[model samples]
Target: MATLSSFLLATSLVLAGCAGGGGGNASGTAGGGGTAGKPHVLKVANYFATDHPQNVALREKFKPMVEEKSGGSLQVQIYDNSKLGAEKEFYDGVRNGTIEMGIPGLIMQADVPKMAVGEWPFLFKDFAHAKKVLEGPIGKEMTDEMESKHGVHALAWSANGFRMFSSNRPIASVNDFQGMRIRMPNIPNYIKLGQLLGANITPMPISEVFTALEQKVVDGQDNPIATLKASGWYEVQTDVLESKHMFSPNLYIINGKLWSQLTPEQQRILEEAAKAAADYEWELLEKSYEDDKKFLQEKGIRFTTPDESFRQAMETAAGPLYDEIYQTYPWAKEMVEKIKAEAK
Candidate 1:
């Protein structure tokens, strides 16, 4: 008889308990670090730039609300731009209880391979379709498995937006993907997609991408367009392929062990704040796409929208990969069907 709200709250009771290292230079904080009546400090780690919506939401929504609503019993300290570490490192930090919380992407699939569903290329129809599936039963099903098997818990699903390709050259057709040297995060979904599209996939971490692009080590890279703007990758990149090839969602996660230690009231406050912050990020990012495209245009970054034929070709290229997924995860076919059904 539990409603969705109750389920989310229960799942998010999977939040912080580990006190992070000192917070003297954290991106945002509502309390002094002097330790008077010492509130519980929740250390949040993410790799997004300080100005990115992820950090903005955390600073604007999550930090303040958790601090205020908990009546200062809980304090949030945000470490933006890998201040704690990169995606995998911070993720491991959360898993081992060295850190309290994080917003990592498909890197989580390393531990929980099924989590790959989030970044599967060309799977999502659009933002609304994604929201329905990931926040509904399907998403809960995945996150529930994630929490039980992995050590981190999902607080809420936030937007990373749809990914676009930016490069030194234009991606005008499915043929352009052939032999293109594209940088991809070292996850199987990305690697397989790139290979199938005939891209010469170059795997690397996000931190090294700028240098790689500037040095011509790779032809291009993929990320949300807003990320292209926020990370300032546009300075060296000349064109964007509005592929929207994949939609990646960032889950605000807390240490599973730490989550269990919190009192019910504290858990409720954190859950509300986390979801509110995630929603705020989604709002900011949805608006940022067009705004960011305009900004990129102003900077002389050209844009390309794949026409119907090209899109179909790209989807066809992805067909074999989906077969592999279905073969690997017995339930992926059913889950994917459920996802497609939502679009109708």
Candidate 2:
């Protein structure tokens, strides 16, 4: 009888231990204290000011979604206004994994000349044409090229709207630009456009443009009306031409390796968030142009709309530059032709 009782006691103890073991696991799965998984902290970097509405909207819309989807396992931090460094440096940081995210102007990729085709002055006819090209295979090719060559993955496409000509002299026709010193972003097509018009191309960073214009280093620079007003360029500039010369695209890129390392679930969240942000950016683009034009008129800034004849003259002058760029990168010509065909 004593031996039987001891056996029963041992069995009861073993079953209790098993039950306790199962309970502990269930508690851990429920995210119990002392055994929960570590949280992931993501850092986003951009050259836009922290107060920029785009940045603010992105954080407000996506930050909470990330935390919720990760079950409180992820947190995102945003650093803006080159709080890190120049735009190029921020791009390099993301490429090398020092920074996890970066938003750089499409023209900035002119550092990799093949990418300059997107910002080629007079290349895109309007927003609709540009959108068809950028969201189509041509843009995809450039995005893939950046990944293969620079180890970065592009997210979504956005824009800075159309660029206009701003200078002290009123530009009523293409001939008016002869011998003028025009500020050119460090992009090849822009320089070519200026050269075609007989203007001296002054290559400088956007941050230095105000001082350059104030000091008469450049007779003027080209940018969207919104950017011209937001950047305070009008304070030093006297005339604005609604040339609509080119459209600027803004791209968000991440390090390829880091992106691949993310879990599929995390990747999905990011892609969806980026698409939403792209839509929001488009809305902002429309409002920005409208608000800016009103403000510029009220500020007594002169606005001129070049006639069709004048537009054709400028385009004709840039024809050779386009040919040169096409010759240098034959692939660009093919892509542009392909985009044109798709639009038709």
Top candidate, metric TM-score: 1
- RMSD from true fold, candidate 2: 4.0
Which stretches of model 2 miss by more than 4 angstroms? 1-39, 49-53, 60-64, 107-114
What's the CA error at residue 78 for candidate 2, in Å?
Answer: 2.9
| Count of clashes in candidate 1 | 0
lDDT of 1 by residue, 54-161 (tens): 999999999999888777778889998888988889988998899998988868776676678878878889888888888898888778767777878889999899
The lDDT values for all models are: 0.86, 0.76
* Alpha-carbon RMSD of each model: 13.6, 4.0
The 10-residue segment of model 2 with minimum total lDDT is 30-39
Give the best candidate by lDDT.
1
For model 2, how does the per-residue alpha-carbon lDDT over 1-344 read when each residue is reduced to its tens digit?
99999999999999999999999888776554432244557677776655444575467665666666666665777777667776777888888989887777764465466567677666677677777787777777767678877888888776667889899889988878988899977776788788897788898867778899899988999888877877777888889999887777778777788888766666666676766776576667666676788888788789999888988888898889878877777677776677667656
Candidate 2 residue-wise lDDT at 170: 92
Assess candidate 1 and give its lDDT.
Answer: 0.86
